[model samples]
Target: MRPNREDWAAALAAADKGRVAALADRIRDRAQVDLLAPPREGLMLMQLRESVAGAAFHLGEIPMARVHLRLTAPEGVAEGGAALMSDDLALVTRLAILDAALVADLPEAPEIEALLAEGMAARAETQARRALSLDRTKVDFQLLSEEDE
Candidate 1:
């Protein structure tokens, strides 16, 4: 089925955004203060909105036919088991993450650097997850959501 542009945009936005109000609540519970810290925590309001806008742009909702540029295969190469490991597809996926991370934090260099680091780790994890899925060998996947797991 063809992807709906609005649902794609909303999914990308929800995946990309944190519940800032909930984060503020957690901070208040942990360390409440009369004058809270400057806007160093979440992305600035405009930046957060721009992220959603950027996602829409990425999905080709801007000035072009909407097409899903996926990472699972490469052009000029036939689709097969090992197509995902091709250098071109890998590079494109990596650059996409880097591009997204570059704009993840706006008007803050340290946050950008931090986002880059997170981006690298996330990219690595995605590759690993993709490989695991491609393996198609079933396992009793225990859901351990922790760095130490």
Candidate 2:
């Protein structure tokens, strides 16, 4: 995916909690942050469809966590938000902080970029491995002809 603001946000959200925390630590030391909305658990409805133009259906409800936060730095103030598919409060908080930091153009932006690259690489590897395994199970068959007497 193209490396843009939204991309960074997604990357941060997809990253491991430990990795997000470690990346956020790089900016937390020098930035002032405020949590406008504390991380909280919630539920969101999931949707699915059988085909591109197929009718949609409600799959089920999934756990979610979200937070809205702001960061103040020498450069300026930046607002951020985080919504997760899981109810990981800490991870959402970290992602929100990182989002604000990236928006604020903190010195740690480069590090966050690196982390994004690493996450993208890992995801690609996982997808490749899964595809390879799936390819092995592909089935092929042909129609047989009956003998004529």
- Among these predicted structures, which one has the highest lDDT? 2
Model 1 / residue 58 / CA error / Å: 18
The 10 consecutive residues of candidate 1 with the worst lDDT sum are 74-83
Runs in model 2 deviating more than 4 A are 13-16, 137-149
Compose the digit string of candidate 2's lDDT tens values, residues 12-41: 665575777987765666778888976688
TM-score of model 1 vs. true structure: 0.24
Candidate 1 accuracy as lDDT: 0.30
| Candidate 1 Cα errors over 4 Å, as ranges | 1-16, 19-107, 137-149
lDDT of 2 at 141: 41
TM-score per candidate, in order?
A: 0.24, 0.76
lDDT at residue 64 of model 2 (Cα atoms): 88
lDDT per residue as tens, model 1, 1-149: 21232232222222223432233233224331222122112211121224654542222221111111212211121111111112233332222322222233212224334433444455567779999998897654554445347
lDDT of each: 0.30, 0.76
